[model samples]
Target: MTRFIEIRNGRVVTPSCVIEDGRVVIAGERIVRIDRAAPPSTRSETVVDADGRVVMPGLVDLHGDDIEEQFAPRSGAETDPTTALATADRMNVLHGVTTKFHALAFEESPEDGRNLENAARLARAVDRGAGALGDNRVHARCELADASADAVAALIEEVDVDLVSVMHHAPGGGQYDAESFERHYVEDRNWPAEAARSAAEERSGMDDASQGQRIDRIGELARRVGVPLASHDDKGRDDVETMAAHGAAISEYPLTLDAARRAKALGLATVMGAPNLVRGGSLWDNLSARKAIEAGVLDALCSDYHPASLLAAPFVDTGESLSTRVNRVTRNPADIAGLPDRGRIEVGARADLVIVDPSPTPTVERAFVAGSEVIRASAGSGAAPELPARSRTR
Candidate 1:
C-alpha cells in the first residue's frame, strides 16, 4: 500500500535555494522527488496546488513551555494532561510546528501546578499520545536548586524524554535580574514582596556543592538516554564553559550576548526565544534576541511560550538571508535534536512541510507531517486559523 502526495506549483524552499514552480513528490513518509517537470500522477495520488505560495520545511521547536498554559489556564484551574496535550498538538500543527519539544519544568511551582510530579504526569500523557498529529517530545527543565536529580533520572527512564536542560533561576543573576524577579513575584505571581525576596534568597543560598551534584546526575542521565542536553539562562562565559564541560550540546536562551558567543565558540547551538524577536526585546529586560541575531550569536529560535512566534519570527528580517532565518526554526533545531530525517525539502527526507501565504499577513495555509496532510486552511479565511477551527487537507 504505497501512499503518494504531490505538492505542485509552489516556491519550494530548500536548504540552498528556492525552486520556483517546483513540484515535490512524497511517497509514503519520505519525499521521493523534487523537480520542475510535472511527473505522471495516478488517480490514487493526491495532488495539492500550492497556488504560488511558499512551501518550506515544517518548524522544529527544540524548547517551548506553552503546554503549561494548556494544563493550567488559570491560577486554580487545572485540565487533565491528556486533554491538555491533545489541545496543544492541534495548536502546534496549525502554526506549522511539525515537531515540538514540550518544555516541562521540574521545580516546585505548586501554585501553578508546574511541579516535578505534574511534569512526570504530563510526560507520561505525551507518551500515551505518541500517535498524535505532530511529533511531541518531552524536554525536562531541571531546576538546579530543586535537588530532584535522582527523581529526574528515574522519570527519564520511565518516560520518553527527548531533551534535558539544566536551569538555575536564583533571583540576582542569569535571566532573573533583581527587578524582573521582584516584578514576577509581586505582580505576576501575586506574592508579597517580602515573601518573594525570601524565596529568592533561599534559592540563592542553596548549597553549591549539592546543586553541582544534581546537575551532574541529570547530565549523566541525558547521556545514558542518548538525548541532547542544554543549559538554560547562561549568564556569562563562565556559565557557558561549565555547562559545556557537563556535555551540554545546546544553550537555551543565554541571558547575554557574551554568553551566547561563548557558547557558540564552545560548539553549543544557541537557542533564543522567538517571542523576544517578535516583541522587539525580552519581557524580563534581558539581552535582546534580535540583537543576538545581528551579532551572529543566535543559532536557532524556539517558541519558548508562544507557538505563534515560531512561524512569525522568521519573517522578521535581521540581516540574515531568508533561508538562514527559516533554518533557525527548521533545519538548525532539527540538527541539534539529532533528527536527521526532517527539517528540509529534499529527496529522501521526511515529508514535513509548511505552506505559507506571506502576503498581507504571514499565514500558514496548510501543514503536512510524514507525508500525511494534518492541517489545511479554509477558503476565504485570510486570518490565521484559531485552534477551534478545523479543516481537512485531504
Candidate 2:
C-alpha cells in the first residue's frame, strides 16, 4: 500500500538548499525522493501542484515555553495541564513548528514544580497516543541553583527527560540584571515579595566558595545521567571556558561577543532565541541575533517563549530569503540535537514538511508529520493560505 504526494512546482527548501521548480515524493511516512523535477509513475497515488509556492522543512524548536503561557493565561487564571498542552500543540502546528522541545524547568516552589510534573505527564501522555495534536517533546531545563545533586539525579530517573540544560539563574547576574532579576522573582512569577527579596539577598550573600560548590554538584549529576548540557547566557571567555570544561555541547544565548566566540571556538553550537531575531534584539542586554548571524557566531535558533517566532525569524531579514531562515529553525536545531534524518528533505528522511506561501505575508498553508497531513490552512480567510489573525506562533 504505497501512497505518493507530489509537491509540484514549489520552491523546496532544505538544509543545504533552496530549490526552484522542485518536486518532493513522499512514500507513506517518509520522503523517498526530492529533486528539481520528479517524474510521475503509474504507482503514484496523488499529485499536488503548489503553484510556485514556498515549501520547506518543518521547524525544530529546541526550547519552547508554551507551558508557562498556558499556566498563566491571564494574570492569575491557570489552565489545566491537559488543556494547556492541547492548545499549545495546535498553536505549534498551525504556525509550522513540527518539532518542539518544552522547557519544563523545575522550580523550587512546590506549586510550580508540581505544575511541571503535570506538564511532563501530559507530554508523555500525548506522545503515547493520548491525543493526535502535535509533536510535543519534554526537555527538562533544570535550575542548578535551586536543585541539589540528589534532586536532579532523581528527576532524570523519574521523568523521560530528553535534554537536561544546566541553568544557574543567580539573581543580578548572567541573563537577569539587577532590575530584571527583581521582576522575575518578586513581581511577575508570583513569588511572595518578601520571600523573593530574602532569597535574592541570601544568594547575594554567598561568596564564590559556596557558589562554586553548588555549580559543581549540579554539573556532576548532569554528567552522570549523560544528558546534553547547555550553558545559559555565558558572560565572557572565562564563562565559556568553564562551560566547555563541563562538556557543554550548546551555548544557549551567550550574552557577550567574546563568550559567543569562545563557545564556537570550543566547538559548542550557539543557539539564539527566535523571538530575539524577530524583535530585532534581546529582551535582556544580550547579543543581537542579526549581528550574531552576520558574524557567523550563531548556529541554531529556538522558539524560546514563542513557537511562531521560529517562522517569523527567517522573514525578518529577507536578504537571506525564506528557505535560508527556515533552515536556521529546522536543520540547525536537529543537527544540534543530534537528529540527522528528520530535519532535511532527502531520501529516507522522515516526511516532516510544511507548505507555505510567501505572498502578501508569509504563512503556513499546510503541515505534515510522518507524511500525514496534520494541519491545513484555515478556509475562513480566503486569503490563499495566510496565518490566521488570532493564530500565534510565538
Best by TM-score: 1
Q: Residues 146-197, candidate 1, lDDT per residue (tens digit)? A: 8557667778767788999998877765778677887887787666688678
Local lDDT at 181 for model 2: 73
Query: CA shift at 360, candidate 2, in angstroms?
Result: 3.2
In terms of lDDT, which candidate is strongest?
1
TM-score of predicted structure 1: 0.93
Q: What is the C-alpha lDDT profile of model 2 across 1-394, one tens digit per residue?
A: 8788877788888767788999898998799888887666556677767778778888888888776677556555666666677678778877788777777665454423334454455455434423444566666666655654455466556555556566666676677765677678656666666766666676567676665676666667656766677778888888888878767788898898888989999999999998888888987768988888888798889988887788877778647765567778888898887677787888898888988776566678888777877776753477544332222121
Superposition TM-score, candidate 2 onto the true structure: 0.88
Residue range with the least summed lDDT across 10 consecutive positions in model 1 = 385-394
lDDT score of residue 95 within candidate 2: 76
Off by over 4 Å in 2: 74-76, 109-129, 148-152, 190-192, 205-217, 220-226, 321-323, 378-394
